[model samples]
Target: MGTPEVSRSPTKSPLTVSTSLTETVDGFHEFKIRSYSLTKGLGVGKFVASETFNVGDYTWAIYFYPDGKSPEDNSSYVSLFIALASEGADVRALFELTLVDQSGNGKHKVHSHFGRALESGPYTLKYRGSMW
Candidate 1:
């Protein structure tokens, strides 16, 4: 036997393709909250929510759940998220969160959308109540 016969599915349709674009900003909002540890006493259930801030053209707030966001975690880990606090839907943007080290080492850890290539434009908020 030299070569094997290849079978193809004729019923399979061509895949549809979609693409999106994200706008980049020259500067960041740089909202810093000091004494973050003090907020831990607030306890779960919206432990601490940042004041409404604007990023791009939409308003947003940072929510920190020191005791985990869902009940499944049982407060083992801290959960941080960004919430859309403005009107409109399908809003898209890039974001980054940084946790500063109190040691003054200047080696803060950062997580951001720019770490990976965006295949679907900016992050879509979907609705006014979306979170990321």
Candidate 2:
């Protein structure tokens, strides 16, 4: 009778990562464009920023691109963006950008990351990290 030899390989257990998220509506800011006409003529890719506001201990601003960011579009549409305007690292939050109707009909256009299911998660913004 003969005995068989077996070999063993060195291996480590798989590492697991866990993250818990606490969601809160930390802050809100309302911006108004008094004269929308004067905002034009800034040329493509240029933007006017709203006064800095605070949200979650971070400064924020709304950027209005009157002529849109795309030069080829030729002002076909206006672009608006929310930006993290202060010093921070990997700051995360949910946001809602809304265009309120002043006509008093109560209809509004809104782009939001609230009261809905997110495929990934909330957004993260670093210091001055924005397309605008």
TM agreement with the true structure for every prediction: 0.66, 0.68
Tens-digit lDDT track of model 1 for 14-46? 899998985665435555667877766455555
- The digit string of per-residue lDDT tens for model 2 on 1-132 reads 789878878888999999998756568788887777787887889888789988766778898788887898598777778888786556777777787766779998876753444555678776674532
Native-to-model Cα distance after best TM-score fit, residue 88 in candidate 1, in Å? 2.1
For model 2, the stretches where C-alpha displacement exceeds 4 angstroms are: 1-25, 103-107, 113-119
Q: Provide the clash count, candidate 2.
A: 0
* Best by the TM-score measure: 2
Clashes of each: 0, 0
CA lDDT, candidate 1, residue 97: 74
